[model samples]
Target: FKQAETSFNEALRIDPAFVAASAGKAELLEWQGEYSQGMSLLQPLLAAQTDDPAVLTVYARLLRRTGDAGKGMDVLQPLAESGRVSGAPLRQVRFTLGDLSDQLRRYDEAFCWYKLARQYRPNTFSAAAHRRFIDDLLLRFDSKSTQQLNRSGNNSTQPIFIVGMPRSGTSLTEQILAAHPDVFAAGERSHIGRIVQQIAPLRNPTRAVLARHAHAYLNGLGDSSRAAQRFTDKMPLNFLYLGWIAQLFPKARIVWCRRDPRDTGLSCFTTNFIDPALAFSDELEDIALYSNSCVELMAHWQNTLDLTIFELQYESLVREPESILRELLSVLEL
Candidate 1:
């Protein structure tokens, strides 16, 4: 975080009115959950860069997060309706407006905006290819195949992965676990997926290749992980790469968070992911289909692997946090 702050500061020092620098700093603050500070940073830039899609989107999101949804909606609706932007920026504005409308209980308007957002965004998610890949994965990683799988990496159980569908309590799960003295919170790492993309297609990736990739991932866990007993990688979509995770770190833990499917669907549909990786979340039926696919994949993992894939139900965890926390921590025996 110091590195991020220093970089942003240096950029701003070089040119105080640099919109990119301001937005980057504000985004860093938002990622750290410093909502008010993020809002303060973004508010000034909105006027300066009124048509800057990045600034407008981040500023509006901060406004919404800071309990100023009306203001946020006001800020986004004009740009979204202007038709002055296309591609990703237009999708962002529509999505932000959808989120603000959802918060305001304007469900019909929210749905309209969300649908438009999804339609306008690039079609990066290929359901057919994804299903074929997952099906092949299940076939390839069954009991016998997994037993013979390359177990050539470090055996250290220093990492705990939290994974599930978007809006499935992954963030909450990470927060509670990281609150413990022994746990370090390493927010979403896309490199894990990149590693899986690199290795999953191989007929057999050698041990050296696997070790190098695993080390690269571990290095991204950040400095706090060095002193902590267990660090979390709470990238929800990592559920898609469970086979690689199981193979790479056979002894490490994977915490799979679950929530009511309808609830998760609604939540995901209403929220703006601002990430292409979660393109499935943009559409309701798509998220549902993807969630069901995840269920099938998880069942495969549970039935086939000997790894500790703890299932944390969303409703139960929040309703009985103490009891749930006790049970959760017991898994680590921390």
Candidate 2:
């Protein structure tokens, strides 16, 4: 990671507005236990795009961890409405908020938030394992959804969705991208789920319904009273909604993160996630089956979407992060 950070810094020297470089460095710093510096760098970007569900979600988390509960809530308020990333981040936030609420003894509100977060992702694994497990499960979801998938997004905001199988390094890739001056990560908004929710009556929602939902969700997210522009979403499971995403946010960029099957599967199976949707948990065979399905799903998306999708390999990024990031940024035209 340090090596990658150095590479990113070099890239930024050539282009300061390089969002991926900045995001990569910031996330590296954060993971290295340099929260103060990481938050310092990310805060400005967040303020610029508080309406971004992904940015708000992560910023709110960092703020709460740094002992600014009130401010964190303030950041999260808007994004919570219609933003749609689920799995772990949502669960973690709700759990934190619930704990905070419990400390204040506001049990009811805490309960509601906890239930909501837990509604999708259960908490059975430690932090490290949770990330890995989700990767496998999300791919399973992606494989199925990517087949008949079709959805749209809010026209008001530009969405750059970062998705793929869990533990495929989507977070790492997003961090690199978000480091860029222009890119902001909205974190994981359940935009896909929100679309699904809106078209609940339809056995299968049309691409138009998905588009309307995406648009409505984004339109509702901006600070409005403030000025904020484009942002990114790292909902790995969003792969399931790619068909709709392509149709709705025609201009929205899609970054599909890829990782070695063995690594991803091992990571997924070894990790205990907070969600039960990952049917492969606790079973290596299940994980292997899921991984194969994910690769197949990716192939399907590439064939069906007819959209410009960027692919980033996790091993490649980890191996030569800056070079990979530069290529990724180039794809985003950053």
Best by lDDT: 1
Q: Which prediction has the highest TM-score against the true structure? A: 1
Candidate 2 lDDT tens digits, 112-161: 66556545533343444544644543553354554555545344335678
lDDT of each: 0.84, 0.64
TM-scores of the models, in the order given? 0.85, 0.53
C-alpha root-mean-square deviation, candidate 1:
3.0
Each prediction's total of clashing residue pairs, residues at least 3 apart in sequence or on different chains, is 0, 36
Worst 10 residues of 1 by lDDT: 42-51
Assess candidate 1 and give its lDDT: 0.84
Clashes of 1: 0
Instruction: Give the alpha carbon lDDT tens digit for every residue of 1-334 in model 1.
Output: 9999999999999999898898889878888889888878776766555577778888888888888889988877888777788987787788888888888889999889878877875667778888898889898888888887786477878889899988899999998888899998889878888888788778667788888887888887778798999988898988888888877787889899999999999888767676877777766667888999999999999998878999999999979999988988999767
The list of candidate 1 runs beyond 4 A from truth reads: 19-68, 204-223
**In model 1, what is the error at residue 63, expressed in angstroms?**
4.3
